[model samples]
Target: MSVLFFDIGATLADVSVAADGSLTFHPRPRVVEVLDSFAQVRKGIISNPGPGATARENAAAALEAAFGGRFSDEALVHWGAKDRRGIFDGAVTSAGPGAGDCVFVGEDPDERVFAREAGMRTAAHPVFTLAAVEGRPVFWARIEAPDDRSPAELEAVAKLDEVVPVHVASDRLVLAMATARGVRAVEQSGFTADLRGQVGETSAFLVRDDRPVAVPVAFAQASAAFRATAEATMRAAAAFAFVSAELSGSRPPVSSLGPGPGGVYIAAAAGVPVEDVHIPGARPGHIERLLPDPALLSRPGQARAERFVTAFAPGAPSQETVDAVRAAVTPPALRAHVARISGAGPLVDGDPLTVRSRDASSADNERVVDALAGRLHELGLEVRRHEFTWRGHRLSNVEAELAAEASDAVVLVTAHLDSTGAEGEFFDSAGRSRPYDPAVDPAPGADDDGSGTAAVMATAECLSSMVASGRTPARSVRFVLFNAEEQGLVGSKAYARAAAAAGDAIAGVLQMDMIAGFQGGTRTMEIHAGSVVPGPVAGASDALADLVAQAGPAVAPDFTVQQLTGAADPAVGRSDHASFHERGWAAVAVSENFFDDTGPATGTRQYHRPGDTLLDRDHDTDYAASIARTVAVAALTLAGL
Candidate 1:
C-alpha cells in the first residue's frame, strides 16, 4: 500500500496552553473521519520536535494521546526537525515505501516543496491526496479573455468549473470570437487596429476544470458575451405590460430609501403616477404597496436564539429529570464548590490555592488533585487516577466512574483542574503589571479553570445522588478532572490515548471550562464544536451542542445559549475535548464567552490571571449553576436516562 506521511500541528491538531502553563494539542475538526477514510492506506506522522527536551517529551505524549497505535513506531517521525530533506528521506525509508510510492500531506508550502523535490508527490491537504489516490478526475484548463471584456469577466467563466484564470491580451478575445464563428483564417496577426491596441505581454495560466479541452475558445466567447446575453434574458423574461420607470430625472428623495416602501414613497414624493413608476423585476401581480419585513431584512440572530430556547423548554422532558438536575445544580451548591476549590472557604483558610504550575512535582498541583479525588470518593464514585510522564514531570488525572446497570457504553464529562496566573508578571488592582517571583506569589485562578473543576465535581455529586436514589443510567458515566491541561493537555491526552488503546466505547465527552462567569445582560453561554471534524463525530458534536442549546430554556430560562462552530478563538480547542476529537470521538466544550471582555457588571477581568478569585460580583455562581444544570440535562439525555 502507498504510504501517507502527515504533518501534526495545525494540519492535524491545534496546540493550546492551559492556565497552569501546560500545553494541549487538539486535533483539527473531522481529522478522525479523515484518518478513518484512509484506513486501508498506511499512515505516518512527520512532525518537528519541540524546542527543548521537555517540550519534545510533551509533544511525544500528545501525539500518542491523539493518534494512539494507529501509527506504528517505525512510521512515526517526531524527533528531528521537518525542514530538512533528510527527514523526508528517512520517513519514506521507515514506511518501507519507495520514494515515488509515498505522498506527503502537509499544510506548509515550504515543506511540500521540499517533499516534492525528494521525488514524492505532495498535497497541501489530506483531502487532495485522498482524491488523487482514489483516481478521481482532477480538472484543469486554460483560457484567454475575448475583446470588449476584462480578464475578471473571463475569469468568472473559468471559475464555473473550478478552473484557474489566465489573462491573455484583449486581442486573444478576437481570436476566440473568430474561432467560435468558425473563421479558420483568423489569427493574432489578422486582428483589426481596435483589437491590436488591446494586445500586450499577457499571462497564460494552467487551471483546474472538469471538461477535456485543449483551449476553451467557446468558454471565453460566452464569458465576453455574458453582459449582453444577461440583459437580453432579463428583458425577455419581463412582461411588456409594465413599462420600465424613469424616476432618476424626477429627483426622488434618496433618503426615502432608508426604510418603508422606498419605491412607492419616492414616486409619491416626486409626484410621479404610481402606475407609471416601474420597479425592475416587478411582475404584473406583484403588490405595489407591500413593505419589506424589517425582521426579514435585519439580523435574525435574536429570533434564531429564541427558537433554540423554545426547543429546550421545560415541557420537552419529564419534570422528574428537570427537578433532579435543578436540585443537584444550584447556585449555592456551585458557589460552595468554587469556594472550596479556590481555597476561599474556611476549609483552606482563605489562602489562594495556586494550581498554576502543571509540573507534577508541584505541591500545590498535587494537593488540588488529592482534594478533588477525595471529594469524588466521598461522593461514592469509583475513583481512579490516570498517571503518565510528560516533559519529565509525572502528571495524574482524577477520574470517577459511575457504571450503569447493564452497559459498557460510556459518557465522559471532564474539566481541567489546573490554574494559571500572569506567568511571572504580577498585576495590581488597576491591572498594571510587574515581574514577581512565582514561588512567592499566588494565582487565585478561580474563574479560568476552578469554575470548570467545580462544575465537574458538582455534576459528579448530583449524578451520584441520583444513582444512590436508585436512578441509574443506561450508560456508564466518567467524571474526569484533567491535570497539566493548563500546561499542554498532558493529562487528558494520556487518558484518551489509553482509552482508545483499550478499545473503550466512549459515547461522547462534554468538557466544561470557564463556565461560571456571567457576562451579564442576557447571560449568554457559548457552545463550541470543531466544524472541520466531519461524519458522525461532527454530527455528534453538533447534536451535543444542540442539546445544550435546548437545555437553556429548561435549565436556565433567563439565559441564552449561543452555539459557536469552530470558535475563531484558539482557546476553544485548548481543553480536554480536543483529545477526544483527535481520536474521532464526539466532544464539545461548554464555557462562558470565549472572548476577552471586562466583566459586564464589575468590569473586573480575571481570566487566566492572578485575580481569578471567587467573587460574587465577577464570578457569578448563579450563572455557573445554570450552566451546570444545562450540562446535567444534556448528560442525562445522552446517558439514555
Candidate 2:
C-alpha cells in the first residue's frame, strides 16, 4: 500500500488564528528524497485557501522561485478547513496502491490523536526549517528531534509539499480565521469539492485582535494580491470574534447560558463570587442550564440575600444562614422526578423523538419501521402497550407474537429511535440536534447507533411479514424501539423492568446495532457472547455462534463469525443488550465489532461527526447492508424463525 502524508499550516492555512496555533513545515530535501524513493507511489499535494504560490498576487514569480518548474500548479489539492478528526486528522487511513495500505505523518499531538483514533499509523515531525525570516530577522529553533521521530512523523515529513494527508478534525477555528480573511468557508454539510483555488507567495505577518503586530503596510502592499489577502484576513478576524463569542457558550442575554449580569447576581447573592463558581466552558446563549431554579428566588418573605446560602457547596452550609433561608423560602410542593425517563405507559407526543443519524432518517430504514408497525397492527397479535425510555427521552414499546405454535417462549428485537453522530439534524429539518447539537457538541454517534436502528427496523419488518403470512412460531417475538441508548442502556433497563413487572416470559433478546459493515469472510465477523449472562443464556450464546457459522454463509452468502470471549465487562455494556442480560433475559448483541470486535475496521474515525453521513467516502453501506443481513439471519435462527 502506498503511504499518505499531509502538510499543516499554510496548506490548510490559519488566516486569523490564536497565539497557540501550531504550524508543521517539511524539510525540502528529505521530502524530495522520499518522493524519489517511492517510484510507484501515487502522489499529490492537498492544500487549502490556495497553494503557497496563489496565496498572493505575484503567483507566476512566486512559483518560479519556489519550484523552478519541478512542480506543476495543478499538483496541489486545496481542501479548506471544515471538519476535524478523520482522514483530515493528518493521518493516512487508506494507502495509494490500495485501501488500508498506507501511513500518515505530520506534526501536532492533537492531530496525531485524531489520526490514531481514526485507526491509522501516525508520525510527528521532529524538526522544522525556517522558511521565511522576519522579526529579529532569522529566528531558528528545533522543537523535536529528527532521529527520535515516530513512524507517522517520518512519513509525514517525507510527504510535505508532496502527498501529505489533509486534516480530519473540526475546523471551526480555521474557518473562523478564513472568514476573518474575507474568504468564505463553504458549508457543504458533507460533500467533496470539485475545483481548487490558486495562491501565491505571501509574506507571513501575525495579527492579534485585528491589529498587525510587527509587519509594515509597505511589506503587505508589496503587491496588490498580498495586500488584499492580508486586508481580507484582518477583516475576517474581526468578524470571527463576534461569531466565536456567540458559540463559546459564555453568558446569557448575549450568550446561551443566561445573561452574564444574571449569573453574577445569582453568584453574588449566594456569597459565591462568579469566578469562584467556575462554570467551565460556558457560553452566552446557554446560561440557564447552569443556574439554579428560579422558584428558589421568588419565595415569599425571604430576604434578598438569604436564598444564596442554601446554594453553597456541600457541608459548607452555614446553619444560621441555612435555617433562616429555609424559613424565608418555602420549597415547592409535590415535585416528583422518575428514575427512568420512560414510564410504563404508551408514548405521548412531545415526549421527544429519538432517531439514529444513519438509520432513523434513512428512507430505507424508515420504510422498514413503518412496514413492520403496519404488519404487526394488521395481524390479530395481542400487542401490549408500554413506555420504553433511554437517555432523557421516552418511547412507546409494543410486544406481540407467539414464542411457539404451542409454547410460551419469547424473543425480543429492538430498534433505537435516537440517531448518533454529529450531522443528523437535516432529517428533522425543523431544526433539532442530530446526536450532538451546538446544545451538546462532540456527538459520538452515527453508525454506532444509527445503523443499528436500521437493522432492528429491517428485522422487525421481516418478522412482521412472516407473522402476517400466518406463520405461527413456537417463540413469542417482541419488537421494541428504545430511547436514550446513546447515554447508556436506560431504555432497555426500563423494558426489562416492565417485563419483569408484568411477568412476561422473555426467552432472549437479540440486539443489532451498526450492522451495515463487513464482518467476516474477507474482513470476518466477531461474535461478542461474553459472560454477560450465565447458564442457559450463555449456552444459548454458544449455540447462536454455531448457528451463525452454519447459517451466515447461506444467509449472507459469504461472511463468517469469530466468536470472542473474556472481554465482557461494564465497558462492554454500551448498548441495550446489557440491560436484558442483567435482567436474566437470554440476550446477545450483534454488531460491526468496530476496532475491538467482528465489525468495521474504521469505526473509530467516522463513527460520528458530519463525515458519518450517508455519502461518507470511507463508509461502505453496501457492506453494512450485508452485515445487517447476517444479523437478521442470526436473530431468526436463534429464535427458531
Candidate 3:
C-alpha cells in the first residue's frame, strides 16, 4: 500500500495564461496513464496554489479540467508552499501511517529536502517515483555516446533495463536519473560519464569544490525561483498519467493527454535516449531549439525566416556578388579590430589599460562599452545606448543601426561586449573556476567574446564601406553589442523584449560569441539554430543557420560550418542569439568549437578566464576573420547584395 504526493508546474505540465485570468492545465506527456497504472495506490497533491484571493479556486478549476474524477479524496488534496517540513509533515499525517509507503515527486531538489526531513521519499521527476518506492537512490547523469552507435544499439549494449534510463535531452546527450550501479553499467558500455551529481542539492548533496569536473553542466539551480500562474498547476494524479502514457502507452484507456514537455509522449514511443524528432519538412541537419515547451505539431508562423533564407537563399547569389563583398572583409583588418577591443593592444579611448572584466559589477565594463561605442561612432553608423539597471548598477547595450530606405526589415549582427575570467578551472577548490569577483580579477575575454565583437565590428565596417559604394542591400542592419551577458543574459533579454514590444521587423539575428578559439588547423566552427518554437515570421531559426552554412563555402572557403541540432547544441540558450529566439524571431549563434573535443578544430582552453586574451596563440585571428567574412556575407546577402 503506497501513497504519493506531487508538486505541479514543470513536474506535471507546462502552463499558459490566457489573456483573461482563467486557468487551463495542459497535462504533461503521460500523466493520466501513469496514475491509472497505480490504481491500487492512493494519490494526492502537494503543490503551491500561489498568492491571490482566488488562487485556490483557479488551481482547482484547472486541475478538474485536466484530470476529472482522478483525485476523489478531497482530504488528500494539499495546497501550500512545500518549502518547509510542515507541509510534507501534514501530507504524511494526512496519508495516515497505514498508507504503508509515501513519496513526494517534483522537479525541484530543494523542496525534496523538506520532504526527506518529513520522512517521505522524494523523486526529482515523476518518472522516478517507481524507483523511489523500490528504495533506489537516483542520481542525475549526462551520457555521451559514439556517433557510430544508434540509440537501439547503445540501449542493447548498455542493457538499459538495469540502468533504467529515465529521460533524455538529446540524441548525443541524455539527462538520466540512475543509481550508481546503473551508472557503472553505462560506463562499461563505452559511453562517457560526462558528468554526474546527486538528485538533492542541499549542502550535503551539492557537488563539492574538490570534485574534478572539467566542465560543469550547471551549478545547482536548487535556489532558482520556480514561478507559475495560479491556473496551470496539475494535481499529482495528473502528473503521473502523462509519464505513464509515454512509458506504457495504448494500454491505458485515457485518451485526452498530449505532450507538454517530457520525453516522447506518443504511445508508439518509449523512453528517449536521444531527441531525433523534428518539425515536418525541417532538414535532418537542422537544429531545433529545445525550449521548455515541445515544438511538436507546429505550423509556419509570421516570423520572417523565409525572408532571411531568401536573402542568402543557397545557390541564389552569383559568385561575383559573393566575392565582391568577401574581398572587402580582409583578414588583417579583422585581426587588428579583435586586438583593439580584446585588450591585447592599445585602448580605443586611450584610458590607462586595466583588467577587462565584463562582470556586471566591474567598473571596467563601462570602459569596454565606451570603446565599443566609440568604434561604432567612428564607423559612421547611428549608435544608441540601450541603458538598463541591475542590482543598483547602470549598464548599457550598444545598438548601431545601418538603415536602408528600400526596406524596414532589419538584420542584426550581435555580440556581447562584456568579458569574464570567472570560470574556475584555474583557481577553485571544487576543481571548477572560482566564483568570479569583479574587483580584482582580470577577464580579458578576447577569444571568449572579443573575437565575436570584432566579427560584428568588422562586418559593420565592411557593410558601411559597401553602402557608401551604392551597394546598399534591400533591408536595413543593426549591429548590437549586448552588455551584462554573463549576468544571466540580462541585456539581450531586455533588448529582445523591447524589440517585441515595439514590433520591430527584424529579419534575422546573427550572433558571434567566441568565434576566434580555433586551435587545430582544421578551421572548423559551429552554427547553432536550435529553437523550441517557430519564428514570429514565415521561417524558423534553421533557415538562419542555413544562411551561415551556405555563406561559408562562398565567402570563407577556408572554414567549415557545422550546424548543431537538438538540445545537444551547447549554445542553445548560452548566448545572445537565444534572446531573439524567445521572441519568436529567427536567430542563430556562430562560435568556435566549444561543443566537444571530437571536432576537427578545438576551442580555447581559457574560456571565461583571463588567459582568453588575443595574445594567446589559440586565439586564431585568421580563423576569426574567416567566420567574420562568412557572417558578413550572410548578412550582406540577407540585406540583399
Best by TM-score: 3
Candidate 1 minimal-lDDT segment of 10 residues: 198-207
lDDT of 1 by residue, 282-325 (tens): 31111121111101111112232233334423235456778888
Rank candidates, lDDT, best first.
Answer: 3, 1, 2
Task: Give all candidates' CA lDDT scores.
Answer: 0.55, 0.36, 0.63
- Give the higher-lDDT candidate: 2 or 3: 3
Q: Give me candidate 2's TM-score against the actual structure.
A: 0.39
The global Cα lDDT (0 to 1) of model 3 is 0.63
* TM-score against truth, every candidate: 0.50, 0.39, 0.53
Q: After superposition, how far is residue 184 of candidate 1 from its true place, in Å?
A: 52
Better of 1 and 3 by lDDT: 3
lDDT of 2 at 84: 46
Of models 1 and 2, which has the larger lDDT?
1
lDDT of candidate 1 vs native? 0.55
For model 3, what is the error of residue 173's alpha carbon versus the real structure, in angstroms, after optimal superposition?
22
Model 2 misplaced stretches (Cα beyond 4 Å): 1-385, 388-394, 397-405, 422-446, 468-470, 518-521, 532-536, 567-571, 595-604
Residues 402-489 of candidate 3: C-alpha lDDT, one tens digit per residue: 7889785898999988877655344565676454567777888888687888788878887778777767778898999988776556
